[model samples]
Target: MEARLKKTECVKQAPLAQILPPVILGGAGFSYQVYPDPNISQVRQVLRQAFNLGLRAIDTSPYYEPSEELIGQAISEPDFANRYPRDQYIIMTKVGRLGADRFDYSPSWVRCSVNRSLERLHVDYLDVVFCHDIEYVTEEAALDAIGILLEFVREGKVRYIGASSYRIDLLLQLAQSVLDRYGRPLDVVQNWAQMTLQNNRLETDGLKNFRDLGISCVCNASPLTLGLLRSNGVPVGSLGDFHPAPAALRTAALRAADYVAEQGESLAALALRYAIWRARATSTSDFQVSTITGIGSTKELDENISAISQILLPTHGSPINSARVERDAPLWNKVQEILGSWLNFNFTSPEANWDVQQQKFVKLKL
Candidate 1:
């Protein structure tokens, strides 16, 4: 009886979110480009594993090939549906990117895309809908898209509205402008590859902005930093041929990958833990985050879920600190420093070039 008491005390757990999972199950790994095409049954099994492990949200996009359809089938399957009703979980998908280098944020496209997403997810409504990658389109285009999506909200088709992108400045601008013009703030915003072990820009700047804009939450996606900070290294030609990363930066990432391999640690594990640990915190105690990461298979999902649970678990001497976030700051800094000149390699924003930036925020008459 005494041993049982001691064992029970050793467990660590955190409260779940009121409406969604704190950690979102991302669909990018299920995309054809990342993994071999997944069959419907495989997707069903993967979703089952994730749900059993306490993940209650799934983030996908129309651009991620057949990911939406596969997810739809898995969640709507007979056995799973009987056990978990449609209201038991949340689903988020995006629109605005049609093909490689093709973007259309027009009102017509936005409505059409949401309708298709509804069809693919096998749900009458979506919990959330992002404008996809706003950095690649104009502010007017995005605003126009938002107006159309809101129409669905009125019809009870969308629960929340938001945008997902990589550019902090553009996000800030869009949020402020929308608030100024519409009298209501964006429900949420998601940024990728910027809140990981190697990069800290999103935490340093984006979170503070989100708080002021009344954004409900800030989500971090792609904690692997687009595979650069991993041991296997990023594959070539995956992010399209334009590749904003410079040659020198790519070489530095490879060297850093090699350094990571020599440490006798799984770089993927360290990277995942680092991102997950910090993602569980905020600049002020008033904020919270929902991190989205892709899981290519059940193996990857198990590793990621275990990593997150380990980070959230209470320690021997101290409990998980809720007042102050960013648990492994010192260790992360050490790892970043040892990477030498490869540290903090990042993309230059499109706004840096006057002519190119003009195309991204052109004003259009509504």
Candidate 2:
């Protein structure tokens, strides 16, 4: 999961910083999964390669516990510092949420967190900052914190403001609330694990509302459904601990993974392409989506990049993975057919009253 996908390797990497990528290098895996690996040096190598391959932007947060520091150390190396520079790339971080299951949405915490992130990231300003895990806090608190973020923007501390969540419906409400208070919508949002091959809730429920609320773009994280949709199935015991997916859904996902293997397709590969295409495909109401997938190593990066390349090119006449045929219609159909019962299934928020949060966002609408 490590080789970075350069513009030349994939379909000519679009250089428009103003435009989001079909895929973004996510930080959760690097920070959580790969961080404690005995070989710390490998992490640096992966970061360097990812950047060289045109993954110019990075997404991290304090809640990731030292992800910001790890990223800072990698990029501050003489070669990376001189080559990429601060403005040449994007550094996206989040505030308002602390350790796992802990959150603080106060303006004071927001201000302090942003300043702390600047120090951790070794930068004066962040390119993008989100009110991390807003679903845990009330919507009023989220709006107040978002207002504080805008103040940082006015001070040039961050360029764009976003909110990350598992609840797409709440995210849409928060976006509209931002508009109601200031006559402007959220610049971006990161919705996780909900737009995968098995789940399309973001597209079916979140996007149209977002478009009307004037949200500029959406970032889909955990396209592998936070490792639930992978070939190996959910990691060790991640199912019940942090994830909210109930036992019934978990059993169904395992069954689907087994079925996918029997179909002679790597679930991971097919799932990645499905998400990338789903994000890139235009919505009926003009909602745009960008993907943020985490890779643990250069090897994973190569697989992901090659998957994107395969889907971008035609079914034939390419040196990419032959397994990733240009035509994915049958695979899509089979996935829907096999995992039909699990499609569009979502879990209840384990934290906070969802209606309370939604009401706040709803009231914020203009």
Candidate 3:
């Protein structure tokens, strides 16, 4: 049996000074909820391959059941330790949101979650920790969670603090509120499915808002819109019927997928290429941008890396490939055309409403 490696010392850096790769490995795919019967060997292989390819940052959550544990187990292996040290990569996980309908942002839960994540990731300190799905919680609770995270920072349990949400309006409100209350901007903010080919609101509506508040890193997650943009359609089975996108958007996605297939290109790849290119094109020095993609297998990891390489060139002048841009333009335009009314549409998520005075999410009306 291989020996488990002891936790190595990590040199802490300022939150803003830490750099994330153009792509982060999203860990939701590692859970049984997302991928049935996840193989530990495969997970270990994917982690090593991703690190070797320069995609070292990982984003997971307790909400992702067993993901953090699996990742912790993988990295603890002696071979993994021999290849990659703790400080060489980044590990980002979330707290607050537990089950789909459950959330806890109280200070006690915040501290507990942080300590639990530290143990599960097998690290003495986390590079980044997000208050997962802040929009679902009340404004006051979210603020309290951030305060606790700030306390953790002082204690050396965490290096950076952030919040992840699907609602652009709510995210902006939270960032501004944090700045006003804490006198410091969130080190990072993450929004999923908003920066994909079908929706560009994170760029169109969010960039300036976040920049105004001095937020440093903006993560564009779920470039495939949580599997909706793929030819196979929205993910079913263990992921449950949890996709919040409406029927109209799903139908339009199907049409767009079919159109892209007819053109001998994958809608999923086109979407990823567009996302990677857009992130590079829109990123500024003050507000660095990156994308997070879930890789269930080494094959998916390779595909994501290929997409990143194809879009991000080696040239110093511009990271984007003008040739690839010109080639994909028509296909992208046609996909948008197919989307039509569904273009840039924002879907409603569960518990979308929040009552500021009550300090909790108001149950959605049927």
Off by over 4 Å in 1: 1-18, 235-263, 283-286, 314-331, 349-366
lDDT (C-alpha, whole model) for all candidates:
0.72, 0.72, 0.83
- In TM-score terms, candidate 2 sits at 0.83
TM-score of 1: 0.83
Model number with the top TM-score: 3
**All-Cα superposition RMSD per candidate:** 7.7, 6.8, 3.9
For 1-366, candidate 3 gives per-residue lDDT tens digits of: 011122232234544523666678999879766676677787898888888787768999999887899899999899887787876778899989888767888899889999999998888888789989876778888999999998888877787889999988988999999989999899999999989889999999998889888888899999999888989878663756778788888999999999999988888889999998888888765567888898888988887788778888866578889999999999999999999998898877534575544545677789
Candidate 1 lDDT tens digits, 1-366: 000011111122111123444578888777765666657766877889988877878899988878899999888888898987876677889989775446778788888899999999998888789988887777888988888887887777887788998888889899998898788888888898888877878988888888798886778898877666666556333444344556666566556556666765555666777776677655233455767888878887887877676565544333234322354444456567765565655675544532223443344446
Residues 244-344 of candidate 2: C-alpha lDDT, one tens digit per residue: 56777777777766777887767787888888777766432245477888877788888787777766443324323434444676777777677767778
Which portions of model 2 show Cα errors greater than 4 Å?
A: 1-17, 33-40, 236-241, 283-287, 313-326, 351-366
Q: Model 3, 295: alpha-carbon shift in Å?
A: 1.0
Query: TM per model?
Result: 0.83, 0.83, 0.92
Residue 66 local lDDT, model 3: 79
Q: In candidate 3, residue 328 scores what lDDT?
A: 95
